[model samples]
Target: MWCLLPTPLCLISVFLLLQAPVAEVFLYVVYKQNSTCMDFRALSACFGPPVPREGLRGYLTEAAPANACQPIGSPPASSNSSEVFIALIRRSGCPFGVKVLHAQQAGYKAAIVHNVNAEQLVSMVADDKEIRQQIAIQSVFMGKSASKHLKRASRYEKGQFWSHLLKYSAYIVIPYVIQEFGFMINVVVCTITLVVCARWYKKGQKITVCTFKRGDKYDTCVICMAEYEDGDQLKILPCSHAWNTHTQILV
Candidate 1:
């Protein structure tokens, strides 16, 4: 096939796509009950070496209650589901690896852990190589706000799954779109500041050195707030701010 686009342009496009902001991840839970769909956005993605890498998207299930006090590495009965399962569980009462591996052994497609101590989201990490390798499912963490809603939805209300269907989909960006927006704002502010500084420099405003004279009523340097005695040398900034030579070092 003959190439239509320029080689450099194609390369740049591929590079840009590959260089997605690493810190940001996408997580969405769609819980459907009869006719209502409750959507939740996960706080952050899990730690290193997410299994399969393509990411997880399918029906979600409660591997256990948000506060299940179970033995470490023990797989619970809730993990037995015929559907592609995304397990939602608390981040305590066991090693994160234990809960995840147990869920994986019982056929969970992914795991969403909720933080118990704090409201902010965190990336779940396993220290053991052996345990990390056993994980063959994607995983992530959610904050308190979303987890509260999720725990309620994971139950059977009045003998039926409160939510008739549970869906879990992972993403790399856009769900954490605020990070990108914040980065952009920082860049724009920096750019605008640089432009303004350059324009000010171009205008050639000169800084003047003011020598203190005897009987001068303005005896205090505004920047350092030091009393200016006779013969004190001051640098008057273009913006009308002034400081004494002794205070210039601090500036």
Candidate 2:
């Protein structure tokens, strides 16, 4: 659990966590003359798709037929002019895996597939194959409107919009993140302490003593050489005498 009384650092961390606010997410494109953000529907078929990354992952500088990514020998080409090279692919002519894999090898961070019908938007659902499994980039789909906008926008600089996910999404923590960290630290400390105590006890480090028993040899205490009477407290010794002088433990 978290510390009963949170330390100054922990309290400050929690306060900072709460103070940060969530930012809205959107797909955007920036050109020399203009820049705009738009909402797009998407279905990510790649493994680990939920990892928050930049919204601009899959964008290509050139507009080409979707078949360009079909060849294994030749992956899709990215323009050297663009810093963030994402592949803009069409959603037809080959398996989605082919497009994703080819673009992946081409060094694009992500790939966007434009719908075949220009008037329609489609979900990206592909089979789990070796090629598909190999891909580890962002892939999204663009509707008729978004696809055209993307093509037009590609003429300019690529998008730079990203999720503030790593920023404020941490604030969604239950209770708070810093508290959780403190709780884990406390749990580890307590566990280690318990283990150490158990080991010490198992090694017989604990001092143990009880009242004199009936089978004890002498009834008198050797401390004052006094005879033990009824209900009288006395100490037994390993030597040939009865007294408060008991076992001499070597420490």
Candidate 3:
């Protein structure tokens, strides 16, 4: 004779089986003090700390330290600050204040805001009323190309460049290509079906032919004040107005 195990005992055994490995691994790492697992000190050393810089005329007053770097949001020397600001407006969502605060929290000393269309450099004043110790603000005008290069360089240092590439390739680029190929195949099948349907419809349709005399006066189109010619197709808009191709005007 065989004995039946209780339901609760089976559940507890499964749960323990699943959780035991993870707990054992965690405790083993903890006891061994292994550097491979989630070490804040090691990760911080890899990225390094932010370099501190004084805000001077909307630019960094000094260079970054050997291990750290700062983001300089300014136009190139040859271009004016206004142009940089305009460019910033186009590429970056807003004037950069909101992102500046986030960057400050991440240890950025100053944000060099630039114009995309002008040459004069301007400084962004942080709202001192709400300023926190982590917040630092600065601005400058750098050309669009220079600004892009600076951003890329910064990402490269933080190991974000490759990570971003991997994310895009996995989620965006590959999926987009697959979707485009699928759409092309679907379009080809639809075209063939449409051709077959059109041929069948023509065989059963009763075609009508009409002739119009030249110089037959018709109502002039109000939009362009042009007389409709023969063989011209007319469309009656939803507003109860009729117009021909030559006389139709888009608002």
TM-score of each: 0.54, 0.42, 0.22
Clashes of each: 1, 8, 25
Candidate 3 TM-score to native: 0.22
Per-residue lDDT of model 3, residues 1-251, tens digit only: 11121110000000000112222100000000111111000000001122112101121111122111234343224233321111122224433344454444433333334334543334333343353333443323334444443333332322211110011124324554687699999999999999999997875353332322355443556577776667765555445455564554567
lDDT of 2 by residue, 157-192 (tens): 333332111232433444456775898999999999
Candidate 1 residues 1-251, lDDT tens each? 11122111100000001124565554454454445565555543344344332334444456554433353232333332543556677877767777777766666566778787677766677777787777776676767777666656544343233233232333534444667699899999999999999998865558778888877755788877988888889777777766787875642
Q: After superposition, how far is residue 215 of candidate 3 from its true place, in Å?
A: 99
Worst lDDT run of 10 residues, candidate 1, spans 8-17
Candidate 3 lowest-lDDT run of ten: 8-17
Which parts of model 2 are misplaced by more than 4 Å? 1-35, 46-48, 51-59, 63-65, 72-82, 118-120, 156-251
Native-vs-model 2 lDDT?
Answer: 0.48
Best by TM-score: 1
Candidate 3 ranges with C-alpha deviation above 4 Å: 1-97, 132-134, 137-141, 151-251
